[model samples]
Target chain A: MVENYNDVKTINTFEIKERSYFSILWGRFKKNKMAVISLYFIIFLIVVAIVGPLVSPYHYTMMDYTALYQTPNAKHWMGTDDGGRDLATLIVYGLRNALIVGFGAGLVEVFIGILIGAIAGYLGGQVDNILMRFVDIMFALPSFLLNLVLVVVLGRSLFTILLAIGLTSWAGMARLVRGQVLTVKQLEYIEAAKALGASNLTIILRYVIPNSVGPIAVALSFNIPGAMMMESGLSLIGLGVMPPMPSWGGLISQGSRWMLSYPHMILFPAGAFALTILAFTFFGDGLRDAFDPKTE
Target chain B: MAQNILQVENVKKYFKVGKKDLKAVDGVSFALEKHKSLGIVGESGSGKSTLARLILGLIPPTEGDVYLLGKSIFKASKNEVKQLRREIQMVFQNPYLSLFPHMTIGSNIEEPLRLHNIGTKKTRKSIVLNLMEQVGVPPQYYNSFPHELSGGQQQRVAIARALALEPQLIVFDEPVSSLDVSIQAQILNLLLELKRKTDLSYIFIAHDLAVVEYVSDLIAVMYLGVFVEFASTEELLNEPLHPYTQTLLKSVPVIGGEIRDITISGEIPSPINPPSGCPFHPRCPYKKEICEIEKPILKEVKPEHNVACHLY
Candidate 1:
C-alpha cells in the first residue's frame, strides 16, 4: 500500500501547485491593456497631485495683481487666471481636493452600504423588506439634486461637501451590496457555516464580507471618478472650495467670466476634469476584470 | 421505540406563485433512528432536497416541525436550534461550490469549532489537522484554497468541513453525484468509514438508487412532493412495492447490458394543480379509477415497510 501510494502523492502535489487566487486574478487583470494604461495614468496623476507644490514655485492663493491673466509661458506655464494666481498651483490643489472627496466619501459610502446590505440580504423577510424599502426610497431620489440641496443647506466646507457626497452616493452602493449579499448568502459555504452553528453575526463578518470584497472593491473604484466629477461640478457652481482657496473648478469658474477673451482658463480646468475621470474609469476597468474567474 | 433520533412531522413548504400558492413539500413525514442511515430518493421536483433543507433548518418550513434527537428544531429558540446545528451538519452536492474559495482547508474545518465555541483557536487548529488527516488531506493542504484541489480532493475537504463539529448526524445531499464514477466510489467508502468511526447517522439524499442502496439502511421513494414507498434498502429492492418505486428501479442503468422501461409516460405534473387525489396519478401507470379521486395514505405492508399506492 505504501509503495503504491506514489500516484496519489504525485496527483496531490500537482493539485497543490496549480495556481494561487491572487496570482490568477492579477494575471487576468494584466491582460487588459487599456486597464493597465488607465492604472498607470491614475497612479501618475495621484503622484503628481501629492508632489505638485514641491515641483512648482508658487503659492496658489498668492496674488500677482499686476500679472493677472498672463498668457502661457515658461515663467507662468499654462498662464494665469482672473485672480492672477499660478494656474499650475490651482490645478494641483484641485487635484488634491478631488482625490480627497472621491476616496474619503467613497470609503464612507461603501462601508455603510456593505454593512446595511449584508445584514438586510442575509436576514431575509421583514429585515430585508424594511432595509430594501429604505434603499429603494433613497435610490428613487435624484442623487445630483439631493447633493445640490445638501450643499445649499450645509454650506461649502470640505467636511460638509464630503458628507453630502457620501450621503447621496451610498444608495447605489447599498443596492449593489444587497444584491451581492443575497446571492452570496445563499451559497453552500454560507449554509455550511450556519450548519456548523456559526452565528448570523459571525457568518456575515467572516464569510459574507470577505467573499464580497471583490464586487465592493470594484464598485468603490467606479464610484471615485463620479465623486470627483461631483466635486468638480459643485466647485464650478461656487458650492465647492471657496474663492481665493484655489481649485481647478474655482479657477475655471473665474476664468469663464471673461469667456472667449481667456479661453485657456476654461480649457485647462475642463482638461483636468476630463483627465481625472478618464484615468479612474480605466483603473476601475482593471479592478473589475481582476475579480472575474476567467481572467487568469 | 426503535431508538429513534429524529422525527419529521407532516412538513409542508409552500411558495406564492403570482396570486396562487404552490405547495412544494406537502404533508411529508419520516423518522430516523440514531446511528442508522435513511436514504431519500426522488426526481428533481420531488422535494427531497427541500426536505433535506428543512431538516437542516437552512430554511424554515411553511408549516411543519423537525425533531432533532426528539427536540423541535423549527420551533426551538435561536440558542436551542444552534445545538441542533452542531449536532446535524451537511455535505452538499457540489463540494467545489460548497467550500469557501477565500478560506484555506484548515480554516474551513475550524469554522464549526469556532462557531460552537467548543475549543480555543490553538486546539481548534489541531482538530482541523486531525480532520484533514481523517479525510486524507495532508497538513500541506491546510493553507491551500479550494481552487487548488481536484474534484475528489475538494469533496474530501467539504466532508472534513462537515465532520469538523464531530456531529452525530450528517445530511448528505447527493454528495457523490457531482463527481466521476471512480471518485464517487472513493467518497462513498470514505462516508462509510466515517460512519464506522463515529457511529454517525446519515440522512443521505440521492437521485441514484444504486448508490443509495450501497450506503443506506432505509430507503424512501418520493415522487411529486410525496413518498410513495419506504422500506429497508434490502427489502425495498428485493420486494419492491408502489408503481413509482418499480419504475425508479427499472430506470437504474448499470454498466452491463441491462435495459428496462425506465421511461414512464407523461411528465410529473405541476405541484400547483396536482392530479386531484394522488399527485403521482398522471405519471403512475398502475392508476385505477379510485387513484384519481382519493389519495392513498401510506400503509405499512410489513413490520417496518410502508407503501402508498392504491394497489398496495
Candidate 2:
C-alpha cells in the first residue's frame, strides 16, 4: 500500500473508483479471513441458542430417578449431574438465556452510550463535564461487583441480570463514542453544516452522529461478549439467574458442586462461554478493519 | 460602485495567553465591495487568517462588529446568524484533514444542502453532481473517500463542498498554501474559474504577496494585528504607502528587478507583546520618536485606498 501511494502525490483522481460505503466495508470485512471464520462461529452460537433445547432428547428440567449421576451415553450425550438432569439438554436450554442477556445488554448499553456520549461530546460544555464526570465515576467501579449488588437489590433474575449489565456496561461505549465525536465534530463537514444554516441539533445528529458510527460499531461488537461473560460469571457465583432457569453460568455453578465426580457437567457450559467470547472478540477486530478505510 | 457586500468595523479579538490578553485582531477594519476579492497579506503572526475568521463568524469579536450585507453579525439572533451563515463559508489550509474521512465524496458535497434543507434528497443528488461537475470531479469519484484523491482533488472537493450552498462569499484561508507548488497553482486557477462562472466574492488570505496579487481585486497588507494598507491590487503593488508594506514587497523574490530581496532586516514581533506604539516600528528602518510613541490611524491616502503609517 505504501508502494502504491509513493508517487503518491500526483494521481488522476478524476475517474476514481465507484466504491459505495457499504461495498467498501463489505469488501474489507471479507478480506479478514480470521474475522469471517469467527463470524460463522458466532452465527452457529446464535443458532444453537435459539433452537438447541427443542432438539435435546431429554427434558432439561425433568429429573429421571433411575439414571441419577449417569455417565455419558446415547440418551444423554454430555452425561448427567448429581440431579440426573441431561447435561446436553441443559446446555441446549441455556443458550436462549445467554443470547438474550448478551444481546439485550449489548444493544441497550450501546444505544444509551452513543446517545449520551454523542450529545456530551458535541455539546462540549457544562453538559459534557457533568455527564463525563458521571461516566468516570461509573467507570472506576468494578462492573462485576456492581452486577452482584444489583442482583442482590433487584432480586436475582435473568431480567435483572440483563438490566444490571446493560446499565454498568455503557461506560466503555460512552468513552468510545465521546472520543469519536470529539474527533468527528471538528471535521469540516460539521462546520459546513453550521455554515449552511443547520441548527445545533441538526449538526449533531445528522452530521456528528452518523459520521461517528464506525467507532460505535467497534465498541458495540467488542462489548457484547464482555456482557455475556459477565452474566455467566454472575450466575456462576450465585448472584445471577436462580437454579431453575438454565444458563451457562448456572450449569457451571451446578457442575462445580460435583466437580470431582461429574466433570462433563461443568466443562461443556464453560467451553461454550469461552468460545462465544472469543468469537465475538474476533468479530469486533474484523469490524474495525472493515469500518475504518484509513487502514487502507 | 459595487454595493458593499461585507463591512468589518474595527474588529478586535483577544485571547488569553500566559496571563495578559493576546490581541489576535486589534481594531482591524476593511470593506469589500460586491463580487470583489480582498487579499490579506501578512507574515505568520500578523492576524491575516484571524481577520478572515472574524469575517466568516468562525469566532466572535471582543470589541467590534462585522456587518454582512449591512447588518451586524454579532448582534444578530440565532436564526439571523444562521441565515447569514448560508451566504458565507470558509475553506481551511490542510486539505488532508479538512474532509470527514468516513463520508463518501458525494455525501460530503451534499451535506450543506441537507443542512439548509434546500431541496429534497433527489434535488440534493443533482446539485451535488452538478457541483462536482463544475469542480472537475468525475461522477465515478463521488463515492470515493478523501484518501483516494490527490491533494489537489481533495481541495477541489473542498471547493465543491464550499459551493454546495451557493454562498456569495467564500473565505480561502491559505487554501493552497499547504499544497505543493503545482497543486497550489491548480487550486488558485480553480478558485479564479469558480469566481468567473459563479460571480462569487472571496476573502483570500496568504503569507505571500505574489499569490494574493493574482486572485485579488484588492489587497490589504496586515502587520501585527492591523491592516497597514488597503488598496486595489494594482495600486497596492505599484505604490505601497506603508513602509511595512513596501518592506514586504522588497522581501519578495524578483527575477530581474533592481531591488534585492535581502532588503527587509527584522522579523515581525510576537502578537502577544507587540511593539510599544506601532507594531511595525522596531522593523521599520525609518523609525522616529513619534513612530515609537504614537500609533497611526488608517487614513485615506488615495480614492478608495487607505494606509496606516506615520508617513501617510
Candidate 3:
C-alpha cells in the first residue's frame, strides 16, 4: 500500500486535480457496459422526445386517409395507427409525455422523500414518531387503489397522473431515505460536523444527503421506471391522458384493440414501451450495483 | 490563575433502555484550564465517549450543564450554541469513520472553516493545505477520498479538520485506539507536538493507560459512568488510590519488566442497573463494608487529588 501510494505520487508530480464525487460515481457506473448503453439509450430517447416531433414527416394528429394502416413503407415509417395518424409521430409524442411523467414523478418522490426522511431520521423523539407514523399510514394505503381514486377524482390529465403517481410512490422512497438517514446520521463524521458548528440544515444538506446518495440514487432510478409503469397501467385501464395528446400507455392501449388482425398497431408502440422499460430497468440495476457501498 | 476553558458541572446523561434508565455519564464533573490537557481513561462501557459528546454539546445532558469559557452550552440559544461550537471541537475514535467518504481529504479539513464562513475560497484552500502540512498529511492527497488514505493518514486529516477552527479545547475520544501500535505512537506524538506548539487544551479519552499518560497533564480514571480517581498523571501513576486505578496501571504491559498477573475480574456492571454503591465495588479487590451500601462522591484526599472510594 505504501509503495502504491508513492507510485501514484510520482505519476502526478505537479498536476493536483480534484476528483468530484460524481466523477467517481460515473467511473463506477461506466464499469457496467450494459448500464452505459442503457444510459445512452435513455438519453437518446429523451433527445428524440425533444426533437422527433419537429423533424417527423407528419404531425402526431395529422391523419393520412390514403396511406391509412400502412406498415414501415418509405416516407411512412413505423406505419400508421387505426386513426391513420403517423405511428412514428405518435410514438415520438408518446415518448415525450412518458419521459415527462416518469421524470416528474421521480423528482417529486426524491424531493419529498429526502425532506421527510432527513427530518425524521435526524430529529428523533416526538418529531420522528409523528412523521414515521404518518409514513406508516401512507405505507398501509393500497397504492394502486389510491392512484386510481386520485385519477378518477382529479379527472384524467397529464399533470394529474404525474401527481397521483408521485404521491403514491413517495412512501417507499421516504422509508428508504429514512432508513439511510438513520444509518448515516449515526456515523461519527456527522457528530464531528455537529461539533465543528455546522447548523442542522447544513448537516442535513451537506453532510447527510451526500453520504446517503448511494441508496437514494438507486431508489430514484427504480422510481422513474416505476412511475412510468404506473402511468402506463392507468392508461391501460382507459383513464390515462386524453386522446390527441399521445402517451405511450394510451398508444399501446389503443393498439391492443386490433390484437390479432393488425399486429402492427400493437407491435410498434408495445415494442417501444417494452424497450424503454427494459432500458430503465437495466439502468436501475446497473446503478444498484454501482452504488452498492459494499463493492468499494 | 489559568483560565478555565471548559467546565462540566455535575453533568448527567441518562438513556432509557426498556424499563430502566441507563446512566451513561452520571454526575461526571471536571474542569479543564486553558493550554492544559485532561486525559480520561476507562474501559469500553465506562461512558468515556458519552462524556466526550456531552462536553462537545453533540448531545444534551439529561441533567446539569457544560460550560465553555463560562457560558452554558445546553442552555445557550441556537445561534449561541453554534457560536460556542467554534470554541470546542472533537476528534472521534474511529479514523476511518470520522471522515466523510465522499469528500476529498482537503475538503474534509476545510469543511469547518467553510461552515463558519471563515475565509474566502482562495484563503480556505491555502488554510487547508497549511493544515494538511501541519498534521503531517501529504498535500498531494488533497483530492483523495478517505478510503484511499491509510488509517494513520485519515486520522491526520481528521486532526487537521479539528484544528482548522482553532478551537481552544479539542476533545479526542480514543483517537488512537483504532490505529496500529506503531501508528498509534506516531499519532500520539503528533498530538503532543501540536499541544506543545499551541495554547489549545484537550479532553483526551482513551482506554490505553500508557497513551493517556503520554499526552495528558491530568488524568481521570472512569468506571461505569463516573470517575473513580482524578489526579495529576504522575501522581495517579505513582500512587493510584482507587483499587480500579491500581489494577488499570498494573495491567499496562511494561518493557523489560515483570508481567504482573493482575486483571479486573468479572464484567463491568450494566449501566442500566449499576451496582448500588461504589460502582466498582463488585470487581474491586479492596472493598470495604461501607462501599456496598452508600455511594461515595469524589472528595479530595490529597492536595489537587480526588478519589471516590471510602478507603481514600
Best candidate (score: lDDT): 3
Tens digit of lDDT per residue, candidate 3, span A167-197?
A: 8888888888889889988888888888888
Model 2 interface CAPRI class:
acceptable
- How much lDDT does candidate 1 score? 0.84
Candidate 3 pairs with clashing backbones: none
The true-structure Cα RMSD of candidate 1 reads 4.2
Looking at model 3, residue A206 earns an lDDT score of 91
Model number with the top DockQ: 3
> Which residue runs does candidate 1 get wrong by more than 4 Å?
A1-24, A33-58, A64-84, A115-142, A255-272, B18-21, B138-140, B254-264, B281-290, B310-312
Error of 3 at A258 (Å): 2.7
Off by over 4 Å in 2: A1-18, A54-59, A70-72, A187-189, A291-294, B257-261
Tens-place lDDT digits, model 1, residues B12-75: 9887898876777887888898999989898778888888888898888998788888888877
lDDT of 2 by residue, B30-79 (tens): 78887899899889988877787788787789989989988888789988
Q: The CA-based lDDT of model 3 is what?
A: 0.88
**How large a fraction of the reference contact set does each model reproduce?**
0.68, 0.56, 0.82
Better candidate by DockQ, 2 or 3: 3
Can you tell me the DockQ of model 2? 0.46
Local accuracy of candidate 2 as per-residue lDDT tens digits, A8-124: 534545345456668878888988898999999988878886777667666767888888878788887778877788877788777778888888998889888988898889889
